[model samples]
Target chain A: MLEEVVSGGGSLIIIDDINCCGRSLLKCFLAAAAHKGDSIHILNFDIPKDELRAGMDSEVAERLVFHDGFMDPLNWNGEAVLPASPFTLKELRVCIGADASPVTLVLDSLSWILLHNPVSAVCHTFQHFQRQAKSTGLNVRQIIGLLHGDLHKPAVVDSVCCLASTVVTVTQAPSSEAQGTAVVLQRRKSRKIVRATEYFTILEHFALKSLGQHQPLMKLAGEKEETPAAETDPAANLTFNLRLSEEERRAKERVLLPYHLSAEVKSSLLQSHAGVAKIYYEPDAADDVDEEDPDDDLDV
Target chain B: MFAAGGSMASSSFRRKVGGGLAVIPGTRASVHNGQLLVSTGASSLDSVIGGGLAVGTLLLIEEDKYNMYSNLLLKYFIAEGVVSGHDLFVASAEEDPSSILQELPAPLLDDFHKNNLDKEEKTTGDLQKSMKIAWRYQNLPKLEVTPAARSRFGHHYDLSKAMSSEMLQAVRCHTFFLPTECGSAICCSMGHAYTLLLQSIHRVIQQEGFDGSCPQKKHKNILRIVLQSLGSVLWGDDICCSDHPQYIHSLTRFLHALRGLLRMSLSACVISLPAHLIQNKAILSRVRNLSDTVVGLESFIGSARETNALYKDYHGLFHVYQCPRLNSLLCDVSGTKDLAFKLQRKQFTIEIVIHVELQGVLRNCLHLPPDLSDRASRSSKQDLSECSKVLNAGCAAMTAGRTHLDF
Candidate 1:
């Protein structure tokens, strides 16, 4: 997913399932941005700032700037929660400050912001940030937003998906641990639409490492019947040896016709036989002899 | 044919521009920048689609049962760009495109380095010489020549060595992550997503100055746009319950507009949709109409017939459901019929199967000197007398090799 984001210049990415998707996606983006020597700013609206900071790998830690709004929600005299209105959003943007180099903005959770403000208001503010991020002169390369799908209505989710350039959804595994979590990453850029799925394991610090491949599990029962154990048994397997027995070999070597005769017959057949063609039928000599000798036979 | 195109390009006197669109040399209708064609990355795929996908065309790859095989092709497409230094615009809805690109298997050539050191120790090294047959096959008599008017983009890829770090570094990628959260401002509407994607791509193309007008720009680049997962339920569509038709309609509109956008710029697009997930033929056909090439892959996972002995030799069936008429002119349609795809450890081959009767083939070839070539040995025949029998036997053996089920 980070590759998709990095390939597309100045994109706004939304990861819908925060917990299921894991913070590793965030770390991945940060690592990529760092690889490109781009500055990184992550708004912490879900996890505590200290833990998020502690989990950061050294590779991308120095490049990252965390906005600890979740730990310390903006409040007016400790009484009212500051809504994620344009005013607060503006304040957040200003607090991050401007850099000459490109920066990647990571919004930890859009659901947290949507909780405080209505969908339309939040969307409008989002458009503002996205435009700023995508602006030609701005150092903002891309903006990544994380949201929880279950918390909002389908229409609202649809709107959010539409607003972003790429959408990745993480479906959590059930508590039984029998199945790994499924992550579907989709990108719609111009006419090209691509989707990929991976099963991932949750590690320490909300990290996700994908399982090697995403092949569907085979149904054992169905496969068992197709190649039953009894049929596959070693005793049941047949082996054929083409080696001929001594008697058969002798029989094959025995000439049915002499080589000279065979050659003469072959040559003769090749040359047309013009004289033997006139007789369509002839009376058998035995039939004529029987008719002539009927009176002399011992018929009495 | 390429020499002719080169000559035409050099003369410039015969150059024709069709309504501001660069008329690709020697082609009647394939209008694009400089007549350059891009590889679909997999040679098997390239052959299936006639020539490599023509510039400015869209390829729709629909997945069957599971997305494993189709996604592999997608990986090939992206990895090809990385290797060829094409600018990539990847908008992924599921996994980070970066991670996918990172995990892509290095092309077979990467192993050439490792194998080179031990070359002297192996007696089987000579086999590599025979392996170049596919590469040499191009020099064969033009059995089914795609006409000169049809620009051939026959850049065959050795999938094994196609991906490398140097090529990846050369690639300029514009990657956007679409938000999937319900009710998030970013995930608001399908139309907005399509619009935002188009705008981003337009910005990418214009920035590169490869929008076909800037011939002065020494670096000619093909903008490759890849979108992953068109109709996954996570794309904010309740595809199962209701609103399915609305989602399909929106997707069609997006693709239609995208196809229109490809014309002005030197670009091509590849999109993969999970047909099993969509579960609607009408919508898929509608999707099909928007693409120039349509390739569908069906693996043996769900069907009971997959277990049959006949299919045991095949990994899957690849249907060239549609090919651009331009490509059809280049390749024999019969050559692509009854195509089965078999994936080896390093590569995949798409070929027609000819099933010969198991009996008599070995005996005939071994006993007789084999067909007309045996005329030299026929003079020394042990039997000169049995002319008719010898003639009949010789005739029977001569016709033996011709019998087979071609389909």
Candidate 2:
């Protein structure tokens, strides 16, 4: 599902919080997009381009056109540093070009742009770029973004999520190469929302392998608790006696409720025939009964 | 716990780079992976950080309180640069770069052997002192000790003596004293001290031909950058002044830019940061994340751990917080975590605690139960020193040219 949403992309917002990084997960999408043969234009502000391309394949890496917002983002180093494009929509489309069908614009991070530009403006630019490209004869299909969720206000993250067609939240999961658990939420063409979560490992070639759906932790705990405590008694830890001593359990049988029928009565009651039922009544001391019929005097 | 995490398959590996390795001064190719590596001045630290700091990477030193040992480490780095004939770029906010340069510990130019190491002692006394230190490792197989102790890349510096003026004069040194570079007035704009510092480092890398992008006709030499106590009030950065400074990510951004510049250059840097003083750990974590390698020093000064019996032999503890994963999926983690560093008269060394070492040795000898060995490892440093003394006695007896049985 993560792969499907990644490849069938419109605008993807990867929300990563503290303790789990989202870059590797973003790489999984980049790899997926590249596998689909979409030219990826990255607006990199977070990390350097080489560090960006560190684990990626040379062939796929070649397909990534980088506009550097990191190296000299503020023109802080001026022309002495490498020529870099500032974060802008015009530069983005100009790089994507009019002829390239299905070009994917990847924001190495939208949070960096959010910090610089107004929250509304950044989201508006991304949303407008999608619609503006269609009318301009541009085949731009996806605008995938990496957002560090913890860095921004909840309102900012909410706004970013509101605009994105797909939001994949990457969090730490150790079973996989510590890659993380991805909870992908997508809005489909039918106007229905779809959400699925799976523990995923981004395998060597940036291949995504789902470790199946995430089992609710409470259910797993419940399963542990539900297993018979016969092997290791749950009563073992109590300071007070809560166990059945064989002798005491037998003694417990001797002491019964007042309403509990005697063994003979219980046996006789159970033995009654199915069709022609027999009343095997055993009277208690409190019972009152009249043997002679009052109607006998009236009959005479 | 490398988590290699259990060895990646051959098919998973990308094609290896094609070339002969370039020989850089004070550097060697890592045996684990074939990336170029340079020393951070402490060889044991280099080993703990998986061979050495790969060139074009940043090594951040989280300074201990009072900034004594981290400062020494920075000096050790400069001294090694001087010895190796590599160029130096030293930056400090609190002190003059030249004054800091003068105080660098002198390098002990002798061979790895203990010969001529104890110059003041008589030959007989030297023999006994050497025997005592040598016998400490006698229980372990000699093979496990020698090769690691004898790495040839970096030099050891004697903390007692300062480098001669003549030696300091010979090396090319660049200075970035913040007080002189940026006046006493703190910048109201974006971190000007930080910007100036970055700009200076950038200028040095570019003009000095450390930048790989611009090929230089001149011969290449590694520039060893020593940044002292950044984020302190003197650096005109306020990350330390208030809990929520106006610019929370100022120092981190500088480090990030520095790292970005480092990746494309032929230089490696060692920065000493007063991380203990940072009020917010999240900001500190961001700083740690920005740097490629981070090692923290916890000096046993006023801390309660100083009075603890377990750490008697060592002066302080050393932590390998993070090591860069170079060219491999997994990081090169050290075999053991119970590591401590000792600053002896001769040099500084980081090693596994003596108790842990004895646990392995005692397990081999007596085949002790797990609990017994645990108790033995927890025994005070005095007991282990006594054990080493007995081994020294045995070694002394064997040295007397008499028939003796060796373990």
Candidate 3:
């Protein structure tokens, strides 16, 4: 199952790169929560809000609170672009005013936040939400952030992973656009860690259906092994010859050697001779045959 | 006859687009994801890169050893921009941008179809008239070319002829040439040509109304940006000079900012990086990661494959390292990985290698190790290079379910 493991307290990080899509998984989480009737506060940076609303149910779309960080992000147009800038989160509390329906905080893309600010500042932003959640009348049930894995340094990604309760890395499945693999790592209260890599398909409406452990990556090698063995001609695609030609076979038949016994020669020799055969035995020096014993010297 | 074909193409172009939004003259929406696409001046190349190049995206071309074919591709791109009436931005360090724009290959009259369209129509009519038994075949509706393909989104170019001066001056042009006249040193990152290039492009996008947030002009059009030999020694970049160049990060950082500019503007970029000369494979992969679509050209001029009988018909190998996955779960990849390019006198065609039916390709060509010196970079590029080797071994077992459409 592509389980929705929303931690009871902390956030979940969805890591993706240019090769795969993490937004689909993020939307799946949002859709699941909205069905349960919880408020979703999304900091929209990557894509427009209409795109997010496209595949979602009408009732679910109503629960989304969009903070416009995409249009006039740098305040370039000089018109009023509400909900504050991406680099600052001081207005986040004012934007989430009077809503206490157990909010699920979603950063549409944390990379955009990181590009303008330092790593330490971003870590502090996560900490500020966790420590100050209850006092501000905002019941932050879950915090989910989507990070582009390749854009940042490995150390930066690892440092962010340390702070999150769950981290999900996504990669595109081989030879498929609709299929992908999700490697999920979750840390529990008892310091126990759980990890799993599951293949999944984005069905119609992007309902993520898990394909379980059946991976196309492993299936490719297995198919390659079976085809060569089933071919009737064993030497079809080999680098060297496995069978000899007719001339080579005939040449092998003509060659003769000392003490090389053929089946035909053995049968002819046995039929030609009909004399009585005598039994003889040879003794080794190590056998300790006594010269005085007459029975020992006789051959029968 | 060509005029008749051109009229048919333009009329069809007008029919489908009546949404009240001004349709750009030479662009169309991608069927897969609805992203706007502009052609790269080569029909065969447009097919290979999963339809034409999308707007507000970067297309990276890894230059061959001699930088021959990559230069031609840049010309094709710029020529397409001029033909389509889009604004042009050409930046190069090796040659003057004006000269690069001046020598673009001539487009074949107005029609893109091979030979004469009228002659082909006459032959088809003759065949239908001669075959009296199959009278019903003439009444069947045609399905050879789709209505979308007939829109002339792309065109054929005669490579042997240069575009006329009248065509070159038909559109707006922006040029950037590195200033080395005063014996100003072209050091690694000090001259700051990349910074200057980025600044000028940013200025043009904002001033010329290419940027989405700030559209200054009533007529909205695309700006085709071409950066030739970007990371080579010519571009005052040092990523190619040593294993650890002083400004190794400069190129990648520039690409990141350039892409950011692209995302908000009606602009598309084509950069030809001399990847083979770059000492660090890590740097090359980073450059590839930053770009949206990456395709490499491997010329066979000095390679052993040039003398081989099996590859005699082709000039070089074409490797598509990456395709952009924009606003979708997966990128649209060309299924067949083994592709070759032939530079005919009149045209250039990047086709699925025709020798796929010849079974065992020249054993020597298959066994030769690729020219890549990659180490410590498991970026999966070497895996792409190894795909053809595995194919020529008579077991295309890896690419099992891929569609190989014979054109």
Candidate 4:
């Protein structure tokens, strides 16, 4: 999603939960965004106040917009047991809409809000935000929801998927095993059209990075080729005209050379049968002897 | 001398018979004073003090379950000194001397009785048997045992006479019970008592020198100087938190004096501080700074928090390498290893993986948005969520492949 947005020539990026690997993500995003003259805006929920200022470079910090208060959900009145804040939904929509630049808006998590608020409210608010972003022609909008084995709760998740153009599921694989994590990206409610699964490994922290670049995207070996019926075979349609590039035709000929046949003269075969006359004369003598023997046996 | 040599040979024989090896004293040797021998009960503690506490050093034994063990060791030291004609002065800050004397193990009591019997040969079997019977009955009331024995012992036993006899001969032993609540106010009084004891000891040493020969007149003068407990007068309704600072300062100064001016050989000072007092960061910080050795006794109430904070502070100071439950910050051992094990064992309800890098990033980001200061201008929920998402993604990506990306 990030790559798609950057490739699409999007500029400013507002990404949340970047703190987790935000610094590294910012580095990568900046590297990519720098090419397109795009500025990255990172908002981290978890970074301590003092360090947020001291640790980040002044240049990056200028573009960075952080919201630290989100750490204490009580500040959002999330502790009220019900979603009471009238401004919450509006604020969410406004935040989604505020990116005037060609930007990708990344929401790090929807899990906290879903857990705190009614599922319907979260879904309604998220859907509204999604529609607003879509209408605004925002270059790219990426919302990463951390689903910690709670994808089974389909109410909010289903709503999220419905509103999202693309749903990427990032999971951590068991470290002791040979297999690493598989990041599956599927278009919303359309499994057939677009389903891409990429393998990723978790390194030192919970930062997920791609596997080796050299690994093949597809593996197809030990497959049996289906034999074509004679009438349906392309090779059988010799009379049909087909256009091919010179390079392609040369490649085709190289593939088809092994099945050609050779024809010898029929006269050679007729000359080989001339020494069989004695066998033909013995057949008439055997017939006369059989008739005489049968008459003599009958008289006795 | 005879007893010391016999014990030494017996110990050597036991070691040889047990392990079939000649024991080598590694980096330590025992010191002897004429016919007297003193050994610290624990080798680890003994190694630090260069042959244990000096003979005349005033030992403060805090009352607790461990007090019994410490007192028994003190008794052994006293017995050694007494036999060598060096006087032992015991000042109990808490327990009753009679009760403690009664609770003394039979072997120890028997040794005292034997010493008494050896001095006063005229005391026959009947009197000896009566004295034994009386000693048995003395602590029965204090003990959760028979009530009849308490009265019987109370009637027959002369505790003062017994104590005097124990302190008889060239070795004069004095025992005083000074019980004070281990609080800030009491700490001040204890500090004063400690100072006075040091000053007197200093005076005695100056006049008589460290040599084992102090004249009887000087010894009498020393014994006449009484150390009184101001606990009862200090315990009044007027006590206030305002007095705490003065007490803390005085206590710190007193400890400094003991450590510096007195220059007395201290084997150990078991300080029994009230849990609440130690929990006060100001008081504890001062105490920690002033004292090298602190034996903190925490009661059941607020024990967990107090113990944890104490361990943390002490661990920070590099005083303790390991505590039973608390992690030693000074040690290079990974605390995460313990956490991971606990997580694997299902010891806690929640497993929290603190992403330090993310935390650092969040700290950097928190200062943004002047609205964050004005609660009304707080960033929208969408903004916060986006921030959370970017942080998670970045963290995941970085952990996965050391990838650096701007969010």
Full-model lDDT for every candidate:
0.58, 0.72, 0.73, 0.35
Give DockQ: model 4: 0.00
**Which of 1 and 2 is the better model by DockQ?**
1
List runs of model 2 lying over 4 Å from the truth: A1-300, B1-22, B110-152, B184-190, B356-367, B370-407
* All candidates: DockQ: 0.01, 0.00, 0.01, 0.00
Q: Who is ahead in lDDT, 3 or 4?
A: 3
lDDT of 4 by residue, B1-407 (tens): 44667856534322213222222111112242221112322222333333333322222322221111233334433433333344344444433444444332212234454577566746554464334223333223322222332111111112112234444444444454432223212222324555554565455544543332444343221121112211111211111122333344555565566545323331222232221212236654564555433222221121232223222222111012121111222312222211100111111111123445454454455433224344524554444555566666424323322111122
Using TM-score, give the best candidate's number: 3
RMSD of each: 21.5, 36.0, 33.5, 42.7
Candidate with better DockQ, 1 vs 4: 1
Residue pairs with backbone atoms closer than 3 Å in model 2 (clashes): none
Q: Compose the digit string of candidate 2's lDDT tens values, residues B124-232.
A: 5646433432433323432322223223478777878889899888899999986557542323244777899999999999887888657756656788898998876
- Candidate 3 lDDT over A137-239, as tens digits, reads 6788888899998988665676566557888889887656437888777766432345566877766554667777544333333444223224376568899
Sorting all predicted structures by lDDT, with the top scorer first, yields 3, 2, 1, 4
Tens-digit per-residue lDDT, B283-397, candidate 1: 7788888887888888765454456444677767778877665434543243435667776655556665432322234334334434445653464243222332433433222
- Please list the residue runs of candidate 1 whose C-alpha ends up more than 4 Å from where it truly belongs after superposition: A1-300, B1-36, B110-164, B180-186, B237-244, B327-334, B348-407
The candidate scoring highest on lDDT is 3
